[model samples]
Structures are given as structure tokens and as C-alpha cells.
Target: MSTPTSTAAGTGQFSQRRGIRLGYQMPNFSHAASPRALFGSVIAQARAAEAAGFDAAFVMDHFYQLPGIGAATEPMLEAYTALGALATATERIQLSTLVTGNTYRNPAMLAKTVTTLDVISGGRAVLGIGAGWFELEHDAYGYEFGTFTQRFERLEEALQIIQPMLRGEHPSFEGEWYRTREALNEPRVRDDLPIMLGGGGERKTFALAARFADHLNIICNASDIPRKLDALHQRCAEIGRDPKTLETSFLVFGFIDADGDRARGLQRDLIERTEVEPQLDRHFVGDPDDVAEQIQRRVLDHGIDGVIVNMVGNGHEPGALESAGKALGPLVHRG
Candidate 1:
């Protein structure tokens, strides 16, 4: 779990005004050479992200292999457990599951876990939840992987139950799938731990975010951002909410390397390791300046508030983040 190193540069026009924030995800999943080895490496990487000035650090919550990532039974770490460890290890950066599956744990239990993590981490935690996807995980865990619609319904009810509880509201929920009665959460989170809703399901998921989440994270082709933003804005209006009130974030995957040849090579190695073709059109890659430029262009062109770069490059390259931030630092100030 690497910590983010920030320079206290004001969130200026480049990022802040546009709500530009930088976050990172640990690349310690199944692509690792060894889960044990990658565990320590990921911690160091988290520290590097902090050193390089990132807003938050996240870990993926998947019990099975994502289709493109190969076999379902690969070495995947549970997000909540990983988060507990990360909370103990890092000091400054906010910790969260990039997006956790609602079906994996009971809603009330999940709320308790987030509050516990918040208390342990001194209130620097974000609860990022999503309707469970990846059927393999559900099957492997012997949890029912129902229809997409059913899963989404479950996810919404989960929010109804968990959010209020986290917010210190004694929540009582009776839904089709889940039932809770006037349950009180002890030692409520110290800070206003914002809820982040993840998923690109335009109508349902986006509306849910507008209604409840403090942050909304979307992952899709870059070209799709404008359309989604428009829809999100529309949803905000429908919900009588201001579009600007919700923080927007993107999940970007790519590599950053200084040497042109080395960068390309690293990208290639990553593509192979992850067993998915590199989607550079939507990724950040190349030399530091190039990477920074791409991020700047994307942010301005699409009105993106911030980016959560999925650091999916080769092993323990400390300079990777530092150099990228240096290149991005100047651009970080541009409106």
C-alpha cells in the first residue's frame, strides 16, 4: 500500500476548478507475478502515488477473473480485507474500494465495515459500491448471480439501507431482497465519508448516483464521456440536484514511462500480462510530458473533474509516478 505524496499545490484551474482530482488503484491483482510479492509491491506503489501527489488510492473488488483477465479462479484479493490492511499502512491518502460488489457482503455488514475502516483510518475512507457484476465471482462464492435487473434492484436497496446508517440516520429498510429494522450503527464514521457509486449504466446507475452518491466514477471509452456527462447532467436536473455538486471521476488504465522505447515496451508487457490488448485510445501512456498532455487534453476536452489512473505498468518503478506528476504538475494549473 503506497501512500500519496502531495506538494500542497493548490487545486488550481487545471484540475480544481474542473473538479480535477488524481487518484490511483493498486495493480496488485491477478496480473501479479506472485500475489505475495505483489502485496508488498502494491504497498510501496501506494506510497509512491502519495509521494507523487494523488487524491485517493483504491483497490478493485473482484472475486473472480474479469473476462479479459483470463481464468476466473486466478489470484484475486478480497477488497474489504485489502482495505483493512491498507488503512493500517497508509497515513494521508483516502482509502476505498474502487467499487465493491453489493452482493458479496450483507448491506448492514458492509456499512459496519466501512465505518470501522473510517474509524481506524481516522475518517479518511470512501464507501464505493456498485451492483455486483462478474458472474463468476457470485458462482464461485455460492452466491446467487441473478438477472442484471435483479442485481441492480438489490444494489439500490443496499444504498437505501447503508447510506443513511453511515450518515448516522437510524435506518429501517424493508425491500424485496433485504430487510432491516431500525438498526443503529455504533461509533458512526468520524468524517462525512462520501459515498461513491460506480457503474456506467446510464439510466439506473447514473440516477442512483445523482440521488445519493457524493462521487460518481465511470469507466468507458473516452469518446463516451460527453454523452454520459450530458445524461448525468440531465439526471441531476431530474433529481433537483446540481450537476456540479457531484464529483466526477474516471477509471483510466495505462502506463507512464520516460523513455519512449521503454514506455512502449512496458505497455506491451502490461497488455500481455493482463492478457488484454492495450487500449491506448482511452489510456494514458508514453513519456511524462506526453502522458500529462494526454490527461490535460482529455480533462479539458471532456470536462472531466478528475482521473483515477489505474497504474497497470511493469513492477516497482518508483520514478514512474514522480516523473508523470512532474510532467503533469504544470498542466495541473491550467484551467
Candidate 2:
């Protein structure tokens, strides 16, 4: 349950040890899952994760589902509102979005919302920020989905403005996408509210995370891990920072099954559902022991400090979650 530490630059920010931080992605786009079911399921999942010893829980922030998912305007809950409800429901696990878009809300307001949620949750909130993606959702909702470069630029600016405000200062900023006066945020509940940036952008995003984020999330081809991590180190060095200061988190799209045949079948079904080729090399699947071993191997092999086992929505049925949580006990609890 406790976060283990490792030497940073050969100096200890934490003890020289690290452990897997188990996290579950609460399904927002799951076709078989509804808002009411999601709310209840999230509550249950959090409790289950806590009892099973997960480190945190996160939800998706989107008005609609990804294109392939049959439903167009499916039931979805706003991220911060659901977070407030989640705060009231859970006791210990940290809460956050997989990554809330900078385009969705004003940076100042989003920062304030997270700080408030952190306070309500007694400092267990993580603000995961990112450049908005999924053009369909933006276009349909009447929001401009600009070029990729523009979004990243906006995301960087948002972090620069919002982090300081959350840290108790009036932030003044002017940017191409967003502008703000010297605005002060009141009742800054949690001084250490962690600002996490998600993406695999090697240039701007990774560098910005090195400079600003408490944590960095890696979401990309599993083969890209070593190269991206190397880039992260380079960025930290460029910023005159110790690379070890930032926590590394990976998002895996996979499953866990006890029976080998059943595991392969589930994986096949998942691939069919998503219409995307399943990359077993990039995923964790098989029995509890097999999955656990894969996770541990990923940690040591990929230089990953923690992992967020993306249940991939309905792909993770009841028994699957149980297997993952129970089997992962060793790696998650290891120190």
C-alpha cells in the first residue's frame, strides 16, 4: 500500500526501493456499462481495489465514445463531477482522470476543481492533463480540433499557468489558444496536488513533463518504451533536473485469465470488439501467475516505475479483475 522509493541521482528522495502501483481504469465508454452502472461499479471497483490493495483509480473524460464503439451519444458522466462523487464514496485510493483535456475547460478552473477535489478527498487527487485528441468528439461537440502541434502547445501553456495557481499564486498568461489575467485561486486545499501529464510526445510534451509534472504517463507502442524513457532522461538533463525525480506510469491494454484457453479466447474477443489487432507483445494476458510474471518483467525490462492496467472497459469481466488484483499482489506489494 505504501509507495516504495529508489535513489535519485544516487541520492535518496525515497528509500532505495520501488513497487508496482496498481490502478484500474473506470469504464466510461463501455457499451454494456451505463452511467448508473458505472457510478455503482466504480464505487464497487474502488472498494475492491482498496481491499485488494490498488494504489489509485482513474476515469476517462469524454463526452462520447471512440468511433468503433457502436453507441454514438452514449451515457457519460463529466469527469470532475464524477470525481466529486468518487471522493465521497472512496476512503483511501487516489482518484484522477486518465487524462483530462486542456481544451475542455479553462486552465484556472480545472486547476481549482482538482484542488477542491483533492481537499474533499483529503489529498488523494491526481490531476492528469493532456492535449485533447479524438477529433470526432471535438468536431461533433462544436469544439475546434486543431492540428496536433497546436494542441500540444496549448497543453504546455495550460500546465505552465495552472500548476502555479494550484501551488498558491496568481498566474498571468497569454497564449495562442488560451489567455488569462493574474488570477488567484482561493482555498488552495492541497499544496502537493500532483500534476501529471499524459502522452508519448518525445519533444515538447515529454520535456514539459520533466520540467513541470510530478508524474509522467507513457501511452504508446510497447516497443517505444526504451526510446521514450531515454528521451525522458534527456529532457530531464536538458532542464537541469534529475530524471529519477519523475514517476513513470504505463498504460497497458490487456487482460488476465486463469485458464490458458479462456485467456486466448478473451483476447481474441477483445481484438474483435475493438477492431484493432491485439499485440500480445505489448499486452499482459494469461493466468494470474503468468500475468503477474509479465508485469514484473515489464517493470524490470521497461524501467517502468508503475503501471495502470487499463481494463479496456468490458474486456475485463468480474472474474478477470479478481485474477488481476489477486495475482498482482506480489509485484504491487513488493518493495
User: Candidates' TM-scores?
Assistant: 0.87, 0.87
Off by over 4 Å in 1: 1-20, 30-36, 69-73, 273-280, 329-335
Q: What lDDT score goes with residue 4 in model 1?
A: 22
Over 1-335, each residue of candidate 2 has an lDDT whose tens digit, in order, gives 12222111221122122222677776544544555565676667667776667777887788875543334566666888888988998898888998898888888789888988988888788888899898877888787788888788777767767777766667666666666677777786645677778898999889888878878888877777889999999998986888777888888765566686677676676667664455666677777788778777765467877778776533335655666778776665565
Model 1 accuracy (lDDT, Cα): 0.74
Count the clashes in each prediction: 16, 1
Question: Candidate 1 lDDT, tens digit per residue, 1-335?
Answer: 12222122111111121232777776446544676676777777777777777768888888765655445666667787887887888888788888888988898899899999888888778888999887867877799889999888888778877777776766666677877777678896543568888988889999889887888898777778898899999998986787888888887765777686787786676567665665666667777777777777775468777777775664257677777656665554355
Kindly report which residue stretches of model 2 are placed more than 4 angstroms away from their true locations once superposed. Answer: 1-20, 28-35, 67-74, 277-280, 313-322
Residue 36 in candidate 1, Cα distance off native in Å: 4.2
Residue pairs with colliding backbones in model 2 are: 5-17
Q: Candidate 2 — number of clashing residue pairs?
A: 1
